[model samples]
Target: MTEPDGFRRAAMQWLEKRPDSRVDYSWVSSFEYEGSRIPLMDRQRGIRKPAGFEAALAIRTTFTAAGKLPPYVDAIGDDGLQRYKYRGDDPQHPENIALRNAMKMGLPIIWFVGVAPGSYEPIFPVWVVGDDPEALQFALAVDEGQRFLRPDFGLDEDTRRWAEGRTKQRLHQRVFRSQVLLAYNGRCAICKIRHAELLDAAHIVADGRPNGHPVVPNGLSLCKIHHAAFDHQLLGIRPDLTIHIRQDVLEEVDGWMLKGGIQGVHDTRLAILPRNRLEHPDEHRLEERYVEFLAAPVA
Candidate 1:
């Protein structure tokens, strides 16, 4: 689906702050049941209550960063409820008071159950609802857009066509992670590190956005520190798949450690090379970025 321009911008900003390193999702289930001592009957019935306020806050924080809202919010009705009103000159106006209320409660902007006041038994025991300026801004934007396109929530044919094109262009970084995992056999390309916790898919080329494309040829599999170094141009990989050390950096103590620890040994060949040569870095792109690296003053 085509997201609004403001939403797209906000999404990009949130994504940019995300680290290039990998995160282990394998242990997520363990943490889900932590510190819970509900009765055996409740556990057997799978009737775990909703998370506490702190837990909900954490979930919201993650969802916002991921450029999405919680799925639970999608249950508000089209007619709206309570202080929220869905019917007006611009019923589908994104900025409707009801829309704001739904979003504020982490509900979906679309029609669903449980969003209307007094619709069902309270699933959430904790009342953690507080003012969030970001959510408020999103609500306002939706409201204005709805008002502008009143009566019909759908965009004009021309606008809809344009949105379709934009939707295809929005790259999900998760795809890159998958590509890296497949390329390196799920191991860190450098140091032959097999521990999943220490491995990451490093971008051989810079991130594709603001003119970068998230293509396989532009990525690599390195650990967290190596990924940061590659991004900062603190490290470079030669076309021959050898590691290239900045001359000045070669003399520093930390640099020496890197050289001996990882960079020094990995010369002449890649620890984990892509099976498809076409997916490897473009020689020209590497050369261009490498030249820029050489021009930087030593710190």
Candidate 2:
């Protein structure tokens, strides 16, 4: 699976130059190498499911690059069923010998997963681990959007059930964050922080609460610290869009993180709003959760 000399080297150079941010399919469209000859994109960018990925993958990855593997190609199987296995560089291409050497060294290879043309960076990943045949199966399990399923993971019944349950929960969290982040344009609603990976979709109503549903209106994009505070009842968002820190938490003589990051912002207006008012947090949902926040023992 060798091609032009610097193909992989140049492509990886592009990836490395990108901001140290989570790579998500929705965040970017496509990246080009050497202008346009080595382009990184799923075949088409509109398909929203795994079908889209498979379609785009035909052109997205290692085929013309070093390993000739698709963007999401499975790890080398122990069953000896691998096709397009990297067979080493063309003897005429001396530079490709280095690429071959690197492959022999077992570097961690990752592929971004999401709807493509891969114009945007990916938030989700498919990590390739040798001998872990379930890597792809488990990847699709958590990526409910991809709707990947594996009926033959070889796990016992009970273990499989537990794994499925955990995967479903992760899927919900991922979908919830994707929606809330897009709604707020990737900024925390309270702090206005814009790092996508650092933000989370904080549930307004607890997920298992009677009326709780995993809809965008029931979520808020909060930074890691704020999401933790909100979930622990140390902070709350009012129906009127004000911040509420637990009285004791506000009064406690705590460190700068507490004062500047949380308590200090109490009662201030929320910093950002979704472009569509209909996408705003549901007032009734917020009210229900706020009551519990008021009732919780002070942190």
Candidate 3:
């Protein structure tokens, strides 16, 4: 009914029309508003408050190394809500003020999380729920389910832990996938398949295992079939980057799909690798996982 409400709804509708993969930096940067162009985020600052808006438009969290939290970590807090740190220690700072205004107005905003260098995953309609001047941060709710949570809300400790763990896992997986896929240029390392929908960011090391972190170095971009094979120990990649198929599976007489798609790639090194050496799969993890593959029981 209100002008600001209309603008916010329009923005959400516009974003909803696009797939998550298409919401890159360029897509986020441009928006047409009232015959004028509005850049949703600042080129330098983490928080964006357009000149004409009473509240902030979007916030960003920059990319950090795997297993490392960014300078401003957006983690689920003790109150069972997401907490976003302020731009700086100043509560009265313009950016902080704008965010506070959004909370007061019940306005929704975008939360751009950096998945790789200069690349981000945009989460929209995150609401600023509570502001803590002492902590110099704001509380956020990503969905309607979280909007009603209060500090005094009696959440069972176990339930809280489960909620937090599940939320963190989903966020971490998304970021990991984005980073891994981007590093490999959206192509499967084993077969060089470039269809993103058919590709998955497979981990060389399981997340809870020793030295397992969801970083790019522990990831490989694999198509659905190869990913399933890797998980089932039907295929493995050595630290030397050589591919191996389980002996039985390799020796089996099978159709073209199994022969060409799986067995045909045996003894070959990864067809694709991250351009940045730092993003390459960790040799130690590869060796560790390869051992598991070798020990896997024959079906």
Candidate 4:
């Protein structure tokens, strides 16, 4: 699906700030219910929202985040529809009922599955695109992305096509970027530039190299230019968390951008480390990848 429009996006940003909750689906039955939806204030404050299905959008979702694994979200039809089941055979399950009401009112639903580790919440927006509920009023949700309530839900295609089209490497790259961005707080580790679109999570070791996994410690948030430089060995990071510019790049004649941006900085402490030492870059991987950087052809 394409991303939510600007108005919706802006509203979502405002709604998400200081989110009231982490998203538990159980709150639906347990929390106060008015008009068959949680009160706006309570929903925003993260109160109880097991049956989130709010009449609006927030960072988590209109329904917000679902705890652990949602009991619903059971099946996807061959033609690209999401099938949500009620617990056991309870026809009047609160979740099922609320979903039916929303569908009847034609209100769209969005929710978070779970936040990936070291990342912010992910959103999965699905509407009642179909009406084949086994029991009356059983709700159906479909982004049909064959996907997640993740940061980049926009890339989701229908489950069938998505599964058919995406590769393991591409999936890893998208998920890895999100994880690295969260750990590094969405800035370039070297330049400390804060533009999110320009940021990249670079692998300390090359992708698919021996022992190179795309986990947080193995990734560094780098801007596009630095990512290229590091990949090409124009830049190197040491085991001790210092930056090194290859001598040729430093000494060769160059433009202002090359001088100030790339070649000028040498032996600087890696500018952006994760807040938690545990999430910081791995020295062992740094040691290994540095060897590859050193051996890179000096162009």
Candidate 5:
């Protein structure tokens, strides 16, 4: 296999060990080769081309302002493909040339999107398919499946809408999950469960609802069981940060799972929360969700 293909395979192997699909800066910067560490990304630049590569191997968007969303839009263009800005003001910059070279060679690279200040969600095997020097950007597609879709034949209107919506939704959920997990120290807010594999970032207000942006304050880190319970209205969190199990669930005469796992936590405040108050769940969104939970009919 070619070097890019080999690198992608290695990245996939590394990602397999990280079920949460989130990586710290350390992981992004480390890929060993012949006992020497080969960083997947540039330590000081957004576009990374390593020592021997003619094409860029990875690109990243950064989240610099604390408690603020990343500035990179990642929005689909008129051609129905996402475009990443070239590094700096000059399109002829060496790093930007590296990205253009990748596009010309049809090489696949990694895209590390910042989910937190120093944390990222990696999208690999991303092909740089188009270089718009006038726009100072390069077109990107996530996988092999999308790499073939060209700007010459843009997506139909309906298809473009669907693609845009789906892409945004998936990216939003990923970033939200990473940020929420980081804020809560990888522990479930309700049960304090620290298993990253079992945790999810539950939304307070459903997506597409008013003020339901996929943001840290609009999310809660919960384990699988509690996430299901929260989604099904079996559990709720009041605006005051108090936990509440549905009356029926609290009264259910089920076995240990229900007794200790769900019921035992009724009326208790959340076991874990972000140290920064700004990262706390939005009280208003919690109130709206809590009201819905209270009105849900018991089975």
Candidate 6:
């Protein structure tokens, strides 16, 4: 794909400023560039500059700034894929022009274009080859909540504000997400069934009201139904993390779903306990809310 001019310029400028880190060239020969395989042995001997060096780094930095960079790329492993070795002209080479173009546009080039599907192991960090000044600049700006011009990059002020706001929300989401993930051990606390796509970061205490702290102890890992129920005060968790179904809610048919099956079965079983006990919900807070939940009539 063709890269936007602004992105390309920003990417180039970033690359020009990157520090030259020593690269491992073990996988160099496995790389294919321009429909030809570069010899691994030749790459080890340092015959030439590997292809697409700038592009790979650009993609890495962009994704890292976006907070979507995969965990594997942050650290290298024993696998050949992470070794930073490749041939100069192999078509499958990491340092290819196509890969570089994808990175400049903020696409998932490493996984989408470079790595094979389902290849789950550590991979090299995207910025290992080149410096990513553009990504670093953007991350710093966002972190500081400062406004800056990246006219070439095309991220306008309104867009930047929106992204910055989302990033803040994501920070909150992550704390809750981690608490929930640990409490449920990556499963739904109410369901006991593990499905990543169906899981949610449910606040044990509601968000942004007089009572909400929006912290780890105030969150739970719930499936969609349970999360909604908790949010609407249709359900509550005891200070012990046990499920608490509002008495009046038991009368409705939909309440039956909450009172029976997976939800019902989970009642009183301390919602999947967190491995770290310190992260557990505060008893006083849960007790206070539990009292409120009990006093209110079920809708």
* Top candidate when judged by TM-score against the true structure: 3
Best by lDDT: 3
Q: What stretches of model 3 exceed 4 Å from their correct place? A: 1-3, 18-27, 65-69, 76-82, 130-135, 151-154, 208-210
Global lDDT of model 3:
0.81
Model 1 ranges with Cα > 4 A deviation: 1-171, 208-211, 254-259
Give each model's clash number.
12, 20, 0, 11, 0, 20
Local distance difference test, each candidate: 0.40, 0.54, 0.81, 0.56, 0.80, 0.44
**lDDT (10s digit) by residue, model 5, range 1-299:** 22544765676566667745777678766767545567887766888888777888889888643366445555567766778987867989999998888888887788887876677888776788777778777788764556777765767887666655655555556767887899899999988989999999999998769878778889999999999999999999999999899988877897999999999998899999898898898888999999999899987
Question: What TM-score fits each model?
Answer: 0.42, 0.53, 0.84, 0.53, 0.82, 0.46
Decoy 5 TM-score against native: 0.82
The runs of at least 3 residues in candidate 2 whose Cα sits more than 4 Å from the true structure, single-residue gaps closed, are 1-149, 152-161, 165-172, 195-198, 208-214, 255-257
Report the lDDT tens digits of candidate 2 across residue range 1-299. 22444544455556667773335443233655455543444344221212212111111222111112344443212221111222122322322222222323422222343322222323222221122222321122223222323333454556555554554365445545666777788999888999887999888987757767656788898999999988999988889999988888878897888889998899998898888677788999999999988888853
lDDT of 1 by residue, 1-299 (tens): 22222432332233334353222222112221223421111111111223322111111101111222433332111211111222233443433333344344543221111211112111111121222232221211112112222212535666544333332222124445555565566766666776767766665545534324444566677877777777777777776667766665565566565767545744445677666676666576666666666676666
Instruction: Estimate, for each residue in 70-147, the C-alpha lDDT of model 4 and write its tens digit.
Output: 334443344333444543455565544555555565554544433343123333344443343454323234444433
For model 3, how does the per-residue alpha-carbon lDDT over 212-289 read when each residue is reduced to its tens digit?
A: 767899999999999999999999899999999999998899799999999998999999999888788888899999
Q: After superposition, how far is residue 241 of candidate 5 from its true place, in Å?
A: 1.0
lDDT of each residue in 1-57, candidate 6, tens digit only: 322234334433333343421112343234443444532222222212224334332
> If both were scored by TM-score, which would come out higher, candidate 5 or candidate 6?
5
Decide which is better by TM-score, 2 or 4: 2
